[model samples]
Target: MDMQDIENKYNKLIIRIPVFLGLALALGIGIGFMISIPRKNTVSEQSSKITEVLSLIQNNYVDSLGLDSTANFAIQKMLQNLDPHSSYFPSDDAPLAKSQLETDFEGVGIEYEWVKDTLFVLYPAKNGPADKAGVLAGDKVIAINNENLAANTTQNTLFKKLRGKKGTSVELTILRGKNIQKISVIRDKIRSYSVYAYAINSEIGFIKVSKFAEKTDLEFTEALKKLVEKDKVKKIIIDLRDNGGGFMDRATKIADEFLEAGNMIVYTKGKHKRYDQEYLATKGGIFEKGDVVLLIDEGSASASEILAGALQDNDRAILIGRRSYGKGLVQVPFELSDGAEMRLTVSKYYSPSGRCIQRDYKNGKPYDKNLVERYKNGELLHEDSIHYDSKQVFKTKKGKKVYGGGGISPDYFIPLDTTDLSTSILNLMRENKLREHASLFAKNNKKILIEMGLDKFDKGWQIEINTFRNIVGNISMNTTQSDYLKLYYKSYLAKVLWGNEAQIQIRNTQDKAVLKALEVLK
Candidate 1:
């Protein structure tokens, strides 16, 4: 196209080219938008279909159906498909679920055990409703509110009868020896402890954390203060075995107590940016300088794993016991319009070493029977049986090798103690014979136990072999098993006389995990 005459034509052609390109791009954009609309509509349509079906069933069904219950069940099933941890709680169960992690609850406040289908009071909470109404330990509860407790009556039924709104009263028919008495107890708020601390020795402290509740961090801080300042303990053993876990914040706060400032304890990532969070340790840690030995087992999950992972990744504590429960997902509770609750898994947390604690559940694995599977695979008895993801290996702050793909593995592995757990022992435990015997013994020696006191009783008390033989009957056991049974009976007697702390202390005298922790601390 050359020179002055072609230049004018070329300019016009270039201008037309720009308009042509704009039209082509617009057409492509329109097609893209058309393709994306169906994906959005598909989700909307599926949701509408569920609602339509529910409405149809509610309006035109032959028999009247509780739509509320149906909807709750449907929601629960849908959440189950998402993950094992996400769950839906009905209105009636919602409060009970939330109350588990609360510091206080309204009830008559008596810890009881079912022996041979009869409920026997282990002990009443001091100054609580049952205690104030003269509900003595070792008394048999025969009826509640005049409703006789049949042999088939479930403990849950009795639990419901005992728990009611604050300031309400319940009548309990108690049988003590040959006499039956009716006692009325007014329900009141009863305080609960998540943290239990005692001196393991003059220089070592033992703290058992049952769960990470709303007041867990505060309670732990108080226990830490008493151990460090009052008891002059330089070493601490934190027992997290059987702690199913509760609040993440509570666990992180406790972890912060042992971590230095500016350290990253854990971090979480999710689908939404708002759910992404990084937890860092703050200043003024209470037990930062002490030697810490953390004990965990298969029952420890969620917040317990977070605490263990933090301490392990930072190389701040020596972990002892079997591998913990693998639950790295973080759930956020949502209150429904009908007063129900939905706990939805929002995020997956990672330790400071960049290892995700969640196990493989999407690969056709049975998530609910994980512990059973672990036992079958011999992971509990042998540390070498544990399957580690070689691809998920990560390094701790101190350059220690740690693995992901599942729970936090302890530095020192202690196999599960199945010794002394014979068939006879199991049968005795199943029938609650030991507890029944202990209750009877405590009832007969109530005056003696009170007068002797816990300290003296702990020092000089022993369940006679003949007394144990009477409870055993024809059930045969070796010396070791017999000794273990006798020790457990003594512990139960301590429980009936004193409380849970006394029982724990007496049991710890020969507990394998506690002994291992002591060895590690030493």
Candidate 2:
């Protein structure tokens, strides 16, 4: 019990404790490293195996192939094996896609509608190469650089021959206004105005945005300015039908235009990053208080969903038409080492109201079956047949109950109508009778057809039923009731002499959805 003996015992105890604690920690570290080391080695081995396989394929193939194409194809095949959404774009395709998404390209700018291997100019872009070259609307491109493009050339081949670097010249043999004339058009850098028609009619401004490209917000702002300059617009209709989507930033920008300051437009979260970016509207805007309506359909996707969801949740616009295409997944384009790109799904996009508009794609299965399943369950034909997610619900800014897991359900549901679609018409279209007849009629009256403008032709063109019937009768004279077929051919002939737009207008005159939209707008 001496003091010196107690002090010596305490010091020894402390030293022993330190030694034991250090040994325990070392053991734990050793165990952790042992577990992880195998996984690291396995991954490394797999990577080596992939490299070996690729090398083997490169060195020993059944046929001689371009190494660049083979590498790109391998990348594409690898992505395809992973998921349906992940896609690869080769070098040649990348530029074209980049130009399209960025809303700029080098070419003669004209929206041409293809029919029966012939390119007919729909409308020349203002201040575009085609416009500068005096390439009028309704002109037919017969040849390009001594090659008869109208004969049997595919559109892809023709576009390759036409599109080139900026300032490059393309010589075209065009049949314009009843004259076969050759014209040279120097291809220039063409910027696509996403908002095509921006005008004010009777104090109501109209701005039509075709796609959510890179220049969408800029173009949209310009459109708003133009419309406001013409007259004060009280109402606006944003057409989102058939637009598949584009840049996510553009969607956020567009949504920010309508929402109030500090409002959440959209927020995305992933495993690696918990991104909660809040997009706010700037102070100045043209139609902050004006009425807005959004038109949507099954074709409307990703960026379109962002726009519709933001506007809807904020009570900024009345949504019209059918349910949107539920594509709430965010895709990040990763450029491969071999000049190829892969669009991989990195995150899921959510609306301001916290609704993920993406439908179920569990088990690595494609969710494209949703629409077809909906149709089979009798959704498209009638509004009553539509199903909503009753269990999963989110509240809007105004406390309205909104569902998740599917798509943006419009405030007003418009049923798809198929009244005018007949078996006879479908048969004729499928058999290429309509296209064939139009080509024949155009050939016979090429001189007269070239002189007609879209407006005049759309308004004045009528089928001479008797003349059409006689022509049809002459073609199928040997068969019985061939004479009766002539009248049917005549009716379609009127559609051909005009444009496909005219035909669509005539056919969709009784469309329930379009009529419903107009009625709601009015």
- Shift in Å, residue 363, candidate 1: 2.5
> Model 2, poorest ten-residue lDDT window?
20-29
Query: For all the candidates, what are their Cα RMSDs to the real structure?
Result: 18.0, 19.1
- Residue-level lDDT tens digits of model 1 in 70-159: 998999899889977777778876665555566788899987866665778878888889999999777888988988888898644666
Candidate 1 RMSD to the correct structure: 18.0
lDDT (CA) for every model shown?
0.79, 0.62
Q: Which stretches of candidate 2 lie over 4 Å from their true place?
A: 1-44, 114-116, 132-136, 139-143, 147-156, 173-182, 197-203, 274-276, 363-377, 417-518
Q: What is the TM-score of each candidate against the true structure?
A: 0.88, 0.72
lDDT accuracy of residue 264 in candidate 1: 91
TM-score, cand. 2 vs. native:
0.72
Q: Report the lDDT tens digits of candidate 2 across residue range 1-522.
A: 232332332332233221121121121112222111236888899878978977888789888778777767777788667544556678666544444455677888877755555677655666789878877555777778878765566545766877788889888888754679888999998877566433223545545565677678788877766666655666676777766666667777777767667777777765445233455666655667777778787667767888899889888888878888777665555555666555655456688889998776665544444445555566766788878888779988999878788789888887653321334433443344433555557657857865875445545665576755543343323232343344334334444455333433443334455455556666
Q: What TM-score does model 1 achieve against the real structure?
A: 0.88
Error of 2 at 200 (Å): 7.5
